[model samples]
Target: MYRSLLLGLAGNSAAEALALRYGMRLGASRFVAGTTLGEALAAVKALNGKGIAVTLDHLGEGIRHLDEADGYMGAYLSLLQAMNREAVNGNVSLKPTQMGLALDPVSALDRIRAIVREAELHSLFVRLDMENSPYTTATIELVRQLHREGFSRVGTVIQAYLYRSAVDVKRLTVERINLRLVKGAYKESSSIAFAKRDDVDSNFKRLIKIRLDSGVYTGIATHDETIIDWTRSYAHRRSIPRSAYEFQMLYGIRTPLQESLAREGYTVRCYVPYGERWYPYFVRRLAERPANAAFVLRNMGRRE
Candidate 1:
């Protein structure tokens, strides 16, 4: 129900206006560091200087124009070069739909190849942001093809909510695919995904255990304390080192926890998103934890 409502509003002009108004005030503190590359660079630099790694995301999804996504790919390549020069322990994250996959997968893949080539120059990595079910197959295919082309620096995300995530994990393991596993953020159908949080978390633990066993450099992306603690304990019992994999969390969702984890000898990467098309991302974040929206509204008047 909530997912349907959000997908419905994703195209609403008026809802976008309202979201923008609320977002402009709340985004600063909630998650988005800025709408520009320079601002993102500063944010990543500050975090990396403190020994905290980062994953910089050029936030805009469900793109309609091939030209727009082409431009997005170019921007990401540029950012990759900057992060290399800045030595910011960071990489770029991207959405296929935002990269012309919605317009044309061929063009999107071509553009992604260019971006990945640029990343290769800097020895930086790219995390292909997974979207809703509609694009999951194409996203996986793109990542697999890129890996085949020797772009090992690129990775993709898998959502535990999906029934096929375990299958995907197994396939990725067979192919030596690096993955970042997240508890599905988008509301999905019970037929296709775990509807309850507990079910999803249970699936998450299973996947984490499998990834750890595979010795693949999987990213455990979650803010749930239980998942984190379980990962820590399982790693310990299995004799998995902290450096074997990494921890990733969305920016602003768990700021202190990210830093704390980094300080505790874990590789922590903050998912820093930026760009003008932050409406859907912002709205979903609100829906995930209504308290976040309330907190944003309650403190919209404060200075950063």
Candidate 2:
């Protein structure tokens, strides 16, 4: 119930306004690097210093206008340039909607293509983030189109909670597209998603195994120690090299665990997000773990 409530608030514009006014003082700073690209780059540098890679996200989505989407594309292009100039060991992730997929699919594709082209020039990878169920098909299609157009440096995420992910994973694997396997954070319907945590975790493990066995590089994005342990054991038993996959975790969620995995000589990447439109991303982070809400509330009175 708590998780659902937070997810619901993720789209509440009035609540978002309040959050913007308060900025990171409401404890969003723990999750969001900052509201600027420079801050995000610094965070990336710090993570790189710790032997951890990063995938930076300029957090904005649910655009109502094409102009907004263009602005987002501009920001991404700038982000790509900055990442290259700074020589940071990181890539980029973006939501399809943020590029106008919902408002105008064609224009959205062009915008995303531009960003991907820019990223390719820097030899950086771009992970098209999977949104809710409504946009899942379109997001995957966009990725397919990009790959066909020679944007081989691009990839997309897969949510294990979804019933269709297995098929999507197999097909994308056959295409040799890299993927970041996540348990998903959206409030999806039971008809199309696994509602029970056990079911989701079980499916997550299944998907991880499928990708690992395919001998394709995968990003196992999760914070569950159990799942992490299972992945480690399975990979070891299968004789999969550490280079075959990397463990991905959200920023500020499990610092010690991320570093521990890195210290163990395993590749670990942090999903570091920034930008002014952080309320939605912040709420989703809270929804993923209600304990995070409690922590945020407890620290709400404190100043950044």
Candidate 3:
């Protein structure tokens, strides 16, 4: 129930406004790097210093106008340029809706294409983050379009909680498109997603095995230690080299675990998010784990 409440608040505009007014003082700073690209880059540098890679996310979505999409496109272009100029060991991640997918799919595709083109020039990978069920098909199709147009440096995420992910994973792997497998953070209907944690974890393991066996590079994005251990054991049993896959985790959720994996000579990447539109992302992070919400409430009385 607590998780559902936080997920519900993720789409509440009034709650978003109140959270924005309070800014990072409400404890969003723990998850969100900051509201600017510069801050995000700095965080990336720090993570890189620790032998961990990063995927920078400029947090904004559900735009109400095409102009906002243009602005986001420009910001992403600038972000790509900055990462290259700074020589950071990181790539970029973006939501399809943030590029106007919700308003017009065609326009959103053009915007995303431009960003992918820019990224290709820098030899950087761009990840199309999967939002909710409503946009899943469109997001995957957009990646397909980009791939067909010769933008091979692009890929999209897959949510294990979804029933359709197994098919999506197989097809995309056959296409040789790199993927980041996440357990999923958004609240999805039980009809389309696995409601029980055990089921989700089981499916997550199944998807991981599928990708690992395919011999294609995959990003196993999860914070579960048990899953991590299982992945290590399975990969060892299969003799899959560490270079074939990387472990991914959120920026603030599990610092020690991330660094520990890195120390073990395994590739670890952190999904670092920034930008002013952080309320939604922040709420989703809380929804993923009750401990996160408790941390926020415990610190709500403290000054930032």
- CA lDDT of each prediction against the hidden true structure: 0.85, 0.94, 0.94
Q: Considering summed lDDT, which 10 consecutive residues are worst modelled in model 2?
A: 295-304
RMSD of each: 2.0, 1.1, 1.0
Count the clashes in each prediction. Answer: 0, 0, 0
Question: Model 3 scores what on Cα lDDT?
Answer: 0.94
Q: What's the residue-level lDDT of 45 in candidate 3?
A: 95
Candidate 2 Cα misplacement greater than 4 A, ranges: none
Model 1 segments more than 4 A misplaced: 1-8, 27-29, 300-304
Question: How does model 1 fare in lDDT?
Answer: 0.85
- Candidate 1 lDDT over 200-261, as tens digits, reads 89999999999999898989999998889999999999999887899998878788898888
